[model samples]
Target: MGRSPCCEKDGLKKGPWMPEEDQKLLAYIEQHGHGCWRSLPAKAGLQRCRKSCCLRDRQVKNSLAS
Candidate 1:
């Protein structure tokens, strides 16, 4: 299998996530859950890609649940 197209830079945001991005993602997941990771970024209005969002979810989710 090959890497996802979403993984490419594609001019998407990179580096550390801003507070607003984390808030938006958390809020969206709280309201609707992360049904489709591939489309979650756009729906949540985040500049990150799917993988970034996935990683963010893990980071935030783990920290919160711990």
Candidate 2:
């Protein structure tokens, strides 16, 4: 498959997310639940794709266990 675009420029708030960013994303999902990833980036103020976000969460979980 072809490479995808960088996780920025598309209006995503690139770089690392602050604690508030993480809280907001988690809170939104906890209250309302997940929606389409294509729309979630903008809605959640995240510059990452749904796929990237999913991967990041997975990595975080994995790291915590070790």
Choose the strongest candidate by TM-score: 1
TM-scores vs. true structure, each candidate:
0.83, 0.57
Worst 10 residues of 1 by lDDT: 2-11
Query: What would the per-residue lDDT of candidate 2 be over residues 6-66, giving only the tens digit for each residue?
Result: 5644665566657776666676666766767667656777767676665655555587689
Candidate 1, residues 1-66, lDDT tens digits: the string is 967566566769988989999999999999998799988999999878898899999999899899
Computed on alpha carbons, the lDDT of every model, listed in order, comes to: 0.89, 0.65
Mark the regions of model 1 whose C-alpha exceeds 4 Å error after superposition: 1-6
Residue 50 error, candidate 1, Å: 0.4
